[model samples]
Target: MNLKTAWIWGLVSAVLAAGALAAPAASAETLRICSDPDNLPYSKAEGAEHGLYVDLANLVAQKLGAQPRYVWWLSMNQRKALRNTILAGKCDAYFALPADKDYGTRGMKRTQAFLDVAYAVVAPPSFSFSRLADLKGKRIGVGFASTPQIVLAAQGGYTTVTYRTDAEILAALDKGEIDVAFMWGPAAGYDNLTRYHGRWRVTPVAGEHMDHQVAVAVPAKDAALLARIDAALTELRPQITALADKYGFPQGQPVAVGMAQVQAGPADVALVPTAAGGTPYGQPSPYRMMAVAAADPAAAGRELFNSTCSHCHSPNGASPIRARDLRRLKGKYGDDWLKEAKQTIEEGRPDAGMPTWGGTLKEDQINDILAFFKTIQNN
Candidate 1:
C-alpha cells in the first residue's frame, strides 16, 4: 500500500482501539435507580408517562452526563422494597425516600430534599378551606388507619368516613358522598387530573406526619456519588419542579391542619376506639398500635408484618376487609390456621391478589411475621 494510505489506516486503527477501551467507562456512566414499577405519579415501567420520579431520574442522570437505568420493583411496602432492592445492592440509588432524619433509612445516605409530600384535602373546586374550623360538620373521607383518619378522629365537629385506598376516597368525593377527601397529596392530585380530569382541587395539609420532604437515597458508602447527585439535583431544580407540575403534584402553601389538638390530647382521645355515640371511624390508631408493638415480645415480627403485609392486611393485621383480616385467622381456619397462613404467604394466592413472598422474603422473616400473626389471631 502507499505510505499515505498506510498512515491513514494506522490512525483509524488507533482511534478504533481507543474507542473500544473507553467503552467500559461509558457503560459505567449509567445511573442505576431503584423505583416502583406500577406506582403512578411516582413511577411506572410500561408507559409513555413514566411518572415523576422516573423522569427526574432521567434528568438528573443527564445533568451528571450519565444514562438512567431502572431496577423496577413493587413498592407497596417501602421498607421491604428498599431492603430487597437498593439495600440489597441491586441498584445505585432509590428514586425517593423520606428526608426526615428520624426516618429509618437502613444506613443509606440521602440527597437534599427536592420535593414535599403530604396529606391533602381533595374537594370540589367550589370548596374553599383556609383553616381547620372550615371542616366542621363536613363529611371527610380518609384511608383506613391513615394519618388523616387519626387526626380527624381526635378533633370534634367533623365526621370521617374511612376507605381502603386513595382511589376510593377520591371516588367518594366525586360521587358527593363526602364533602372532602383527606388523603396522600400526590395520589389525590394525580387521580384528580388523570382519572377525574382535574375536576377537584387538592390542597396540601401541614402537621407532624402530615407532610414530609422527600430525597433520593444512596448507599452510605457512596459519599462521592451522593455529592454528585445532590449537585445535579440543585442544578436541575427548575426541571424537577416542572416534572412535579406535569404529574399534578400538590404545591403552594399547605393549610395548617389541627395536629396540635391531637397532640394536646383531645377530651375524647380514645385514638383507636370504635365509633360509638358520635365517634368517627373504628380503625385501629397507628399510635396505639405502635405502643402495643413496643411492648409485644414479637415487636420485630410486628414491624416486619407492618412493613411487608400491612398494605393488604391493614396495619397490625387488623383489616376491616373480611378476607384480609388476619385477626380472624384462628376463627376461620380452626387448628390449621398457622399452616394455612404460612402456605398462603409462601405460595401466594395469585387469584386472590396475594403475591408470593417465598422468593423475596427470607425464611426467618416470614417466620417472624407468622409469629406476630399468632399474637393477633382471635379464636
Candidate 2:
C-alpha cells in the first residue's frame, strides 16, 4: 500500500527541516524512536498500551542501556511522519519497517529483518479447512490490493467478497457476513486480541508475494546506529518474538497462500474471478499460473512431494524429522499449514538443504503440490 502520494512527498523537506531545526540537544543515553500515534498493533496516541513498535523500541533501548523516548505524530500519511520525525533526526530509529531498500530508500536504511509478517486467513476456531478448495464455495473477505484478493480472483472457485480496508475486512469477518477473511496478519491478529478478544484464528500466509519482512529503520547516513540496532535485534530475538506473540503477531514459520489452491476437477485451468475493487493498482501481478501436469497436479504433486520433499518432510508423519513432518502441520501451526507448506516448496530453506523450486516448477504445479500436501495434513 502506498500510504502517501506525490503531494505528500512534495512537503517532506519542509516538515523534516522544521523538525531538525527545532530539535533539542541529544542525549547519548536516550534511544529516540518514531512511530504513528494511533496505529494499533504498531502504536497508539495514548502510550498506555504503547503498541508493538513502542514496546519493541523500549526493549531495544533497555538492551542498549538507554532510555526510550517516542516521537509520536500522525502517521496517517507515513511519508510525512517518517520524513518529519525519523529522517529529520528528530528520532534515532523507526520501527516496523519493511526490511527492503525500496521500501524507504529516501535517506533511510533498514536494519536486518527482525521479523516477517503476512496476510492471514481469519476464521472461527471450529472451521476445519485451510485452503481455497477447503473453503469449497465459502465466502472469503479480502481488501483491495491484497494478495488474497489476487489469488482468490485467480481461483474463481470460492465466492470472493471485498473490503476496502483491514477494518472493514475484520468487521465483515466478525459479523459473520463472510465465512473467513484474508488480512494482514499483525492487523488481523492484533484486532483479534484487542477488539475481538481472540474471536477467530489468525494464520499467516506464505509464498513469495505473501509475507513481508519487517525491520527497524534508521538514517542511511548513520552506519553506527544501524549496526547497533541490528546487533540489539539479534541479541534480543527471543524477547522480541515473545513480545510479537503478546501482540498477536505471526512468528517463525508461516503458512502459504492457498487462496487459489483447490482440489483438481474438470476446470483444470482456473478461471479468473473479478474482484469488487477491480485490479490491485489496476495492474495484474506478473505472476501467472502455469498448466498443471495433466493427471491432476495435486496427485502428481503428491507423488512428487512424497518422493521428493518427503525425504526431508515426511507426509505420513512417520519421518525422523519431527520438526519437518507434513502430517503434524495443524498440530504445529493450526490452519496455516497449506500456506506455509506452499512457501516452503517454492522458496525452500537452502540454509537447511531444501532447494528453492520457484525456478524449477511453475506456480500452478506448486499449487497442486501444496494441494496434495494439504490432503495429508493431520490437523
Candidate 3:
C-alpha cells in the first residue's frame, strides 16, 4: 500500500475507535429508580405488566436520554425503604411518594404530582355511595388498622367489618359478607379489573387524608435531575393518564364525603362544619370545634404507630418482611406475644436495629401502640 493511503486508513480507524469509545459513555447515562418489586398497580419486578411506576420510570428515562435501571426494594416501610435505597445511594429516584412537602421527605426532593390516589368505595353496581351518611346502617368492609377503619370507628353508627388486606375485603364483598368495601382506590381498581373482571364499581371518595397526590422523589442534591424529571413528567402527563386507565385506576370526579375532624388525642370524632354552600376540593374545610369526648384508643394508637413505627414495622403493622411483620406476633409467640412485645419496646433490640422507646415515648403512647397491635395480630 502507498504511504498516503496507509495514513488515511489509520486516521479513519482512529476516528472510528474514538467514536465507539465515546458512544457507550453517552448510552451509559442511566436513571436508577427504586421501587417495590411486588407492589402491583404501582410497580412489579418481573412480568408483562410492570405496573404504573415502572412504565412511568421508563418513559421518564427515555425523555432524559438515559437507560432505566431498577433497584428492587419492598416498600412496606416506606421511610426505611427510602433510607436504605435512595438515601443510601442505591438508586437515583423513588417512584410514587406523596407529593405533599410536609410528608417525611427530609433529604429528598419530590417532583410535581403526576397522579391522584385516594380511598375508594367498591360495591356492586346497584349500590350507591355519594356521601359518608350513605355508609350508615350498611355493613362496610375495611382493612384492619387502615384509615377507613379509624375514620369509621371515630364516626360511630357505622358497622365496619375489618379485613387484613384490600383483597380480603373484596372477597368478603363478593361473598355477601359485607354490603360494601372501602379501600385504596388503585389496589381495589386493579383487583376489580384483574380478579373480578371489573364487575364492581370502584368510586373514589374525597375527605381529609382520604386523597393524596403522588410524585417521584430524588435525592435533594440532584436538583438538576429533579428538574429534568419534572419536565419529563409534565411532557408525559397524557401518557401517564393513559397508563392509569390501562391499569384500571379509578378515574373521574371523586364523591365528596363531608370532612371529619379527627383528633390524635382522646376526643370524640366531630364533623367539620361546612360553609354556606360546601367545602371545595383540595381546600381546607371550615372548622367548628365541639366538646372533646372519649376517643377510640385503637384508632388513636393507629395514628401514633403510622407516624413512628411505620418507618420500620410498616403501616398498620402489615410488614411484608417476615421478620418485622407485626401481624404474625401472636402466631409466632403464642399467648406471651404481648408481654414479649412490651419488653422489646421498652428495651432496644440494638442488634436488630430496633430502638428503645421507653424514654422517647410516653407510657400511654406505648399502651396505645400495643392496643393497635392487638387488633392486627394474625391469630
Candidate 4:
C-alpha cells in the first residue's frame, strides 16, 4: 500500500486499540496541562480556555476522573518546558504535541492523535489555487517553525516571508503585503473567521506530508499513563471534535490541489502586448527582455504554461496526480466558471493545493492565461 494508505490504516488501528483500553466508570480529578499562554486556538491562559489542546485536556481529565489545570509556558523551546512541568510532576499532561520523535526526543511520550492539522493557504476570495505550482512566483506569509515554511522551502521560486507569530502573518495578509499566508489550521481558521469575519478563504492541503496528528504529551517513563491517556482520548474523541468546532477549528472536506507534473525546460514566452511594451506569462520572463519572447498570445501562453503550469497540470491536460484538468475548463466551468477560474487563478483554492497569484501575475498575464484556457477548452 502507499504511505498515505498505510498511515490512514495505522490511525484507524491505533484508535481501535485505544478504545479497547479506555478508563471505565471514572470520576474527575485535577489534571494539569502545560500550554503556551498567548497562542490561541491551540492554548491560552485567559478566559474561556477554548483552544483545542486545552479543551482536549479538559475532556481527558473528565474521562480519567480528573479536573483540568493550566500551566502556562513559552512555546519557543517546547521540550525543555514540558520536561520541567509535565515530566517533573508540575503538570500531569502536555496537551497538543506533534506525534513525531523529532519534537521532544529527550523525555516525552505521545498518545494516539486526537486531532489532525494540515497546512492552509489563506488568500483573497478572488484567488483559487489547485496545486503547489500555482504558488510559484507569489509572495507567501509563513510562521517560523511552522509547516508552511518547510513546504515552501522544498518548492523553490516562490518568495516566502517569515514571521514570528500568526498575528504578524495575518497583519501582513490584511495589509496586502503578501499574496498568501501559510498558517496552522486551528489558529488561522479561527482568526480568519472571527477577526477577518470570514473574508479569507483558508484551505487545507491533503496527503500525509501535510497532515499533522496532534497527541497528548507525557513523561517518557510514563508508559502506563500514556496508554491510559490514549484510552481516554479514544473515549473523548467526540468531545474533542465538539470543542474544535466551538473554537473555530476548520473541519471541512479535503480540497484537491493541482496534481504534480513532470519537469520541462523553461519556455520563451512573451508577455501579452501592452501600451508600453510586451511582458511574459511567468515571472521575470527573460525572453521578453531579450526580444526573443513569443509575439502571439497563444505562443506566449503555450510557452509559459509548459514551463510552469505544465509541471503539475500536464501540457496535454494530463498530470502525475489528480489536479484540475486544463483541457476541461469549458466542459466543467460555464459562464460561472470564468469567475471561478479567475478566482482560482488569482487567490488559488489553497485547500486544494492551488497558491494565490494576486500580487505575482500581472492582470494582462492572467488574462492571457484565461485566453489560453479558451483554446484548450475541454470537450
Candidate 5:
C-alpha cells in the first residue's frame, strides 16, 4: 500500500482500538508511531519493519500492553509535519529524532536516545584513504540535505556530488562514479558489506554533529505518555542494541583491511549485490558474486579490498585509527582471531564501534574477507 494511505489507516486503527477498550479504560495505552516509509536500516515496511527502531517500537508496545500503530511520514521536511501530527493527536510518538532541542514543543516531549548514529564515508577498493584528510582533491558523493553534505560543504576542498538516498549513492560508488560517498551510518554500512560483498569501506567521521542520537518524540500535551515512553526506552535499550546487531549497521568502528599484496582472492568468494542491482547499475545476482571480477578467491578478495576496504585500512593491514587493517588481525589478534573475524564480519562490533555483517555478507564472501586478511602480514 502507498505510504500516505498506510498512515491514515494506521492512525484510524489506533483510535478505533482505543475506542473498543470501553470508555475511560484505566490508563490510555494506545501508541501510534510515526516514521518514514523508505528509510532503511532504520524503518521500512518490509523485513523487521525496517530494522532496530521498528523492533524497539514493538518491544515498547508489548511492555505497555498497548496496540502499536504506524504512520509513514516523509523523512525530509519531517519537523513541521511531525508537529502537525502530534498536535492533531494523530500520533502519540514520532521516532527517529536527532534529539535536538528544536524538536520539543507545547505537545512534544523527547525521550532519551536509544540509538546513536552518524554520517560515514563509503568508497571503492582501489582508492586509498586512511583518514578524513585523504578525501582531499577526491570526488565524494553525498545525500542532499544530509549531515555529510552540510559538514563537507563547510569543510571545503574536496569535490562533492549529491544524491537523495544511500542506494543511489552506493550505486554510483560501485560504478566508479565517485571516489567516495558520505552516508547514513547504518544504511550505508549494511548495504555496502552485505549487498556489495564487503566491497567498500564505510568510515565514520568524528566531529560536531557527525554523530547524533535517535530518540522518541511524544506529544508534549501528555506528560504521562512522555514518561511512559522514557521508562519503556530504558527497559528496551539493550534489546534495541541486539536488534541493530541483527541487521548490518555498524555499532562501533568501520572494518579495516590492508591492500598491500592483498590481491583478489578466489572465485568462490560469495558476494552480495546492492539492493538497486539490475535495473540501473547491474542486475542483482540471485546467487552471490565475488567482490572483485577475478577468478581467484584470494585475488578477488584483494582486488575487492584494494577497490574498497583498502581506502580505510593500511596497505599492510594497518590503520591509524578510523579503520583497522584486516591482514594484521591474525597473529596480532591471537587465537581468537578467526572467531573474532567471523563475529566482526557477521555481527559487527556494535559496542566496540563496528557495524555487523552477519545479516549482510554471505558466508563465502565473509570467507573471502577472512582469507584476504590471512594473506597479508604472513606474506
Candidate 6:
C-alpha cells in the first residue's frame, strides 16, 4: 500500500475524533503535507486558503512539479497528532517545526530553514525601541502565556493586556486597544499584510530563547525525500524569502535591536508552551513557563488542564480514551481521589503510553492541575 493508505490501519480511534481526515486521492504527482486546519500563518483547513506554511508548501510542491494536497489534522495537541498523523504515514511533509533535538519527540527529520521568527513588537510605523526597558509604562499586548508576556512580566513595567490568539493581539493593537503587541512574528506579519495591507511594524525581540529556527519537517523513516526537500529549500531560499514578504512574515534576522542571530543549522526545536499551550512555533505549555508570574492559580490551572490534559482525559465532555474517563471519577473515589490522582499521574502506567509527569512538573503545578480538575468534574 502507498504511504497514505497505511494511516488507516495505524491510527487508534482517538485520532479520528480529533478530526483526522481520510486520505484523499493522490496521484504520483501529489504532495500530501500534514497541516492543522485551523492554525493561521502556518496552515488551515480550506484549500490552501492562507497561512505562510501552506503557501510555502505549495511553493515547494510547485518547484518539485507536484500539486500540493493537505492531510488535515488538528494540532491542538501536536504530540498526539505527530504520532497519529505524520508518524502514522497520513502525510509526507510538515512545513514548519522548531529546529531542535527535543522537538517532535521522535527525531522527526527536517530540511534547511526558510525563516527564523520570534516574538516581535507590532506597532505603528516610526515605532522604535532599543531594549525591553524602552517600552516601559506602555500598554502592551501579548498572547497569554507567551514568551513576550513572560519576559515583559519578568521585566516588570509594561501594563499587560493578554489575548488568546496572536491575531487577536495584533487586531487589538490596530484598533488602538494597546500601544504595542508582542506576539509571533509570522502571525502578526500575516495580519499586518492581510488585515492592514502591510502597514504595521514588526521587530523581533532579542534575548536568550526568544528567537527560534523554523524548518520544514518530514517523517523520520523517509530519508530519500528529505534530501530532495533540503536541496530544494536551500536553492529556493530567495523565492521563499519573497514569499514570506508577500505574506507579511518576518524573513531574515531582525537587526540585533530587531534581528540576526548565529545558531546551529536546521534541526527540530520545541515551541514554547503558551498559556493555552499548543500552538506550534508559538509555545509549548504553561507548565514549562511556570515562572512567568501567574495572577490566578486556578485560572493558570484551567489553561494548563484544557490545553494539555484535555487531549485524553475528559475532565468534562466525552473522551475518546475510555480507559481514561475522568467524567465518572467522582463516584469511583471519595476524599482520597486527589491522592489516587497524584499517584497515577506521578507514576503513569507505562504500557499505555501515559507519561509520568512527576519529573516534569513541580508540586504546586501538579496541585494546580488538580484544582482545575476539581472544578470540572462531572459529579
- After superposing candidate 2, which stretches have Cα over 4 Å from the reference? 1-28, 258-379
Best model per lDDT:
3
The true-versus-predicted C-alpha distance at residue 208 of model 1, in Å, is 0.5
**Per-residue CA lDDT of candidate 5, range 1-379, in tens?**
3333443444566566568654334343557787666666667766534656666776776677765687766555554556557667888787667575653445677888777666677776666656666787877877643445544443445466756457878997888878888776677877875688878766665444355566888877778878888899898767887887776665756333222111232334432322221111011112223334345566655544443344346443467663475655666678888888787768767787565656455677667667777777542
Query: Residue by residue across 1-379, what tens digits does model 1's lDDT show?
Result: 4323332343444355457553323332556789888888888887678888878887776667665667887876666777898889988889887787756555799999999887888888788988877888887887755777666655645667766567777887888878998888888888888899998888998876577787899998999999999999999889888988999999968998755677655543444433211001111123322233334437657755664466568789999999999999899999999899989989999898887777656666577777888888786
Task: State how far residue 14 of model 4 sits from its true place (Å).
Answer: 34
Q: Which stretches of candidate 1 lie over 4 Å from their true place?
A: 1-28, 266-379
* TM-scores, one per candidate: 0.67, 0.60, 0.66, 0.55, 0.55, 0.62
Best by TM-score: 1
Clashing pairs in 2: 37-44, 37-45, 206-255, 206-256, 255-339, 255-340, 256-339, 256-340
Worst 10 residues of 3 by lDDT: 276-285
lDDT of 3: 0.75
Candidate 4 lDDT by residue in tens digits, 165-208? 67878988999878988776666788887798888877777643
Per-candidate Cα lDDT values, in order, are 0.74, 0.66, 0.75, 0.62, 0.61, 0.65
Query: Which residue pairs clash within candidate 3?
Result: none
Which portions of model 5 show Cα errors greater than 4 Å? 1-28, 46-48, 124-130, 144-159, 162-165, 254-379
Clashes of each: 0, 8, 0, 32, 45, 19
- How much is the lDDT of residue 263 in candidate 2? 26
Model 6 TM-score, all chains together: 0.62
Clashing pairs in 1: none
- lDDT winner between 2 and 6, please give it: 2
TM value for model 3: 0.66
Q: Across residues 68-144, which tens digit of lDDT does each residue of candidate 6 receive?
A: 66778888777777777778887789866776556664747987767777767888778776566668877788775
